[model samples]
Target: MRTTATSRPTSVHLFCGAGGDSDGFRRAGFDVVLGANHWQKAVDTHAVNFPEAEHLCVDLDHYDMRKLPKARVLVGSPICTEGSPADGIKRPKAAPTPGQLSLLDEGPIADAAWERTRATAYDILRATEVHDFDAVVCENVPRFATAWPLFHWWLQGMAILGYRHQVVSVSAAHIGGENNPHAPQWRDRIFIVFTRQSMRQPDLAVRPPAWCPTCEQDIQAVQSWRNGRTIGKYRQQYDYRCPNGATCGHRIVEPYVRPAASAIDWTDTGIRIGDRPHHGRGPLAASTLRKIRLGLEKHRVPALVAVNHSDPGDGRAVPAHASPLATRTVRIGDGIALPAPFITEHRGGGSTTRAIADPLGAITAGGNHHGLVIPYRKGGPTTTAYPLHTIATRESAGLVLGSDALPEDIALEDCYFRMLSPREHLRGQRFTDDYTVLGNGGEQTMQAGNAVPSNVAQWIASALLEVL
Candidate 1:
């Protein structure tokens, strides 16, 4: 029953899981005409969220692109797990540390899967030829660009198709809390926007301004940073050592620092300054802070260097600051450490004298068996303690332990670990409370994790609008 916005540019979303990206496009004033995906549950959820759009629950490889409606913009998020660092082919050459290694070799299977996945991107490009779309936006993990022949082939194909492209890496958390409070989860992703040769190449370097808590201002935060000499800038052996080796605090290396690509220095000084939260803001609630830390580690983002904490009840102790365990140190003389009195631990380990406190000081997904322990604080709501934010997977849901339960909340004790209800997953993904997530817990979880953050999608789409 929805009427088409004839005046607006139309967009076709392929691999449109849960329609978060499409939601952004709609917010950006694009008429989202079609959303196609392989998963019926995802398509069902998309239909529920975007009931007006034409929903095709067919696999992209089989879908007929020529039959699709003509549109000016095309956006796709190809499967990332196959091309991600999480994939086996991209596994680090170094052996994993104890308790770190994943036993399965996802590479060969993933590579085979990627062969099919990469086809979706190429298929979109081919459709571009027939449809003559004005622009295309593709997203995936930054590691996607590192996939062997696939990356090279993709660029070649783009060149042949007459599109100019640029890739920008961004994080949902650093996108700024004030404007995007809905998507505080820390997720790093890359966006590649390409314009047809006939169209004016847009300056796709545009990024959302980030709020600096310390400065109390919105700043054009640098999106990426590079430090140290550029690779392949080979100099003679004698030229490698620093001229001021004795006085210079930095290590002696080849004498070239790439022009600071960003206003924010990648140097340790910049990291320290950039990482500080806003002034006068109360420390993130202890339970919330613990989840953030665990999430950051999971995402491989740098851990927060300092936290406002209290001593643990058990004898286990930890360093007051995020130093000592530091492999590389940046001496930023900003001595502002705010106080949030909550239990603390160094590296989630207990002190030698005392066993690690119950509901360990550092929060993690823990293991499959126990799930995460909701920590006890003096006055906060006890019901929702730990694993505070629901992740995309059922395995990522919060679990409770009987020992960690209080006398009053004995009812929840038997429930022990519990998966986040569908509504919670939707909220974590920044979806509105009314948004419907189809299917059982497992399928819904996959859809949630795979969907792009609507805020990020809107941010990118809005920026693309200026260029388009």
Candidate 2:
């Protein structure tokens, strides 16, 4: 640890699965004590990665908080299958689980995940209040707070305490990660950032100023995010650190994505194009397209680079990697004078690790996948539809993307097409090739596709930390 603010004494974690948020909080300089219930792999991973922090495997519903120490920050990720809207139209809490519904089946994994999360959240909140920690950060499926009744109660309960909840949605990339290189894997989630409002300085406001463009987009996207949405639409950059936390001593790597364009929506300015200097332009960029005389191409990108206009006496300085198109499989570029718009997310995941698992996807080499297009309609007869191989819709000219996604441009078969593999999807999500991309084939593929691009994360996190 850098012995920074995260090194404080009061930090604690409940239902901390897989330690994603824990790592961010740790990087932010807070000590972390992770707690979880049947998440064995996650607990093991947390211990392996964060040995400095204690990992308690005991169930929070029964665990004694007095025996444990306190911390400044509290983080939790509640499971959402049961309470989430994605699971289906709401189910009454009283509905009988397998244990109650049948004498034969005793275990219900979905029910267990949901109930445990609730128990853990309540326990953490109460215990943290007991300790009077400075802040509490609760993370989970974005809709969990809105869909679950008990979640609503927890929010109200937290309000009664001195802390008022400030729900802020963040991308994994902003906290420091890589961007997906190829396809867009949108993972938007809602987090409840709670702190003692009175204790927080006015400048530490989590809500960005009204002028921040990203904040405006987030506000606009909330409604699109409500009901079930699509998967793998947007992805942001994220990072993996080196032995030292300082960037001066580190090498940063990320995916080679279709970099965001610098062009702004000029419509807002109300300035006529004719009034502008760059006029009589078929999209100034298109006019400058390098035409290959004999199919031999030449030119700068469609305005990827804009020459700086300088006085006759002053020389215009070109950037270091002034490109001829970078070839690295995974490369990240800082937003030039032009700040990139956030990768826009659709109704569902919204370009973060904010995933809601869908067991209904096709059987890939990995596990099942969830997506925009779903098969197997409820109560519908066995209609004349075979298993789909391609997520494609033919447009007037050629092929355009379909509900989910089609197979690779080079895949041999059709109906046999599984959604993009994790590696390809990782590439699609804008993660660099150097990072040790992980997942056990299908599961690994899902993991990579579901993760944020590290480069993007580093940029966003750095911006956030500077404010801190």
Candidate 3:
């Protein structure tokens, strides 16, 4: 459990998905109230988990902040799919080429969604300021902070409200473990922390009681984060890794293990081992896969596309990168590297290509299959050589790769064979063992996906607590 500095607790939350953000503040000894989608299930989840506080299932846009409970800290994370750049915009990227027009520059649905989402965020920030929350924390995809215009307005609003603030993109890798090993993986998330300005810079920011950043092997590193943006030191990501090395490969993906419902890690209620995949798992169901893909396209997040590759092992098959039309090399991560990509958020959630590789004829775009492929490389069909890292030259190979692994593995509950359960994913998000997630039914898995990772909330809460 984290030590709380405040004599009294803080209270505030918005877009409070299953209480991931709220869990942190509460852990930091804050009295948190929640606001989020009016879905009965979500509201119930919040109420059940944090019964000591209020959980309002009202639209933040319609609710008046003045009428809401006032507390020292406020926090939130809006729906990311609607605003993420990962979703392809209806607008074309870059300047228009000849007769074509930029889709984002012209489309209706795209423009409406973008404007409404950002506007909503701006309204909430303004309202929070008016209500006098001492500190504010907003979480979102790293791109969300930069892609929208309204965020600039937030800075202005903070200036008007007499608060100093800063935004940093942090990742789950900071909380990684040997079983997790998601370092080297990059899934940039933006965390914005702000504190009310007091007496115009006369007060020195509270520095932690610590020893040194210049310490030796026998000592632990001491550090601090400030809302005033004193990023005089290296960023967190840099601090987490070996500066001389290449990417660590593992990154933050969807949480796969559920945290304990209590602070103890070894209780009977602690995470039970379940199915998680290694390599060789195939795509999830079609509908579920589509949601992630469509979500990415709509949000403008980039997708991998196979351009040219060589398959030295296989004789001649490959499939298209999830990318539409044709593009350069498709993007994929080795399982040993980054945090695994998120499983579909909702059940039966769809595929967005986990691994894309090319080999001799295996990785060609000729087939409808996804994942690794062996493509026909040099020479002709009889004499060609394929590379393991890619598959391209020709699109068609005689057979598909190990897609059967998915069903068989998901069917079982063994090591590296099982599909990631909702519980595991929640754990990945960093939820502590305690935050309760109430699902609609008795199915714990559903509840896990629906809720936010408690650890992420902990990070935010810890930062907010530091504002004292």
Alpha-carbon local distance difference test for all models: 0.45, 0.34, 0.39
For TM-score, candidate 1 versus 2, the one ahead is 1
Best by lDDT: 1
Model 2 lDDT tens row, 168-211: 45433222223311123324455666667666421222221111
Task: Give the higher-lDDT candidate: 1 or 3.
Answer: 1
Residue-level lDDT of model 1, residues 294-347, one tens digit each, is 422221212122111111111112233443111001112111111111112222
Model 1 Cα RMSD, 1 decimal: 14.7
Q: Which residue pairs of candidate 1 clash? A: 213-278, 310-342, 316-351, 374-386, 399-417
114-189 in candidate 3: lDDT tens per residue? 2323224565566666777667776666545555556677678777887787666454333232332221112345
- Candidate 2: worst-modelled 10 consecutive residues by lDDT: 292-301
Residue 422 lDDT in model 2? 39
Clashes per model (N, Cα, C within 3 A): 5, 63, 85
TM, every model: 0.57, 0.45, 0.49
lDDT of 1 at 365: 15
Tell me model 2's lDDT, rounded to 2 decimals.
0.34
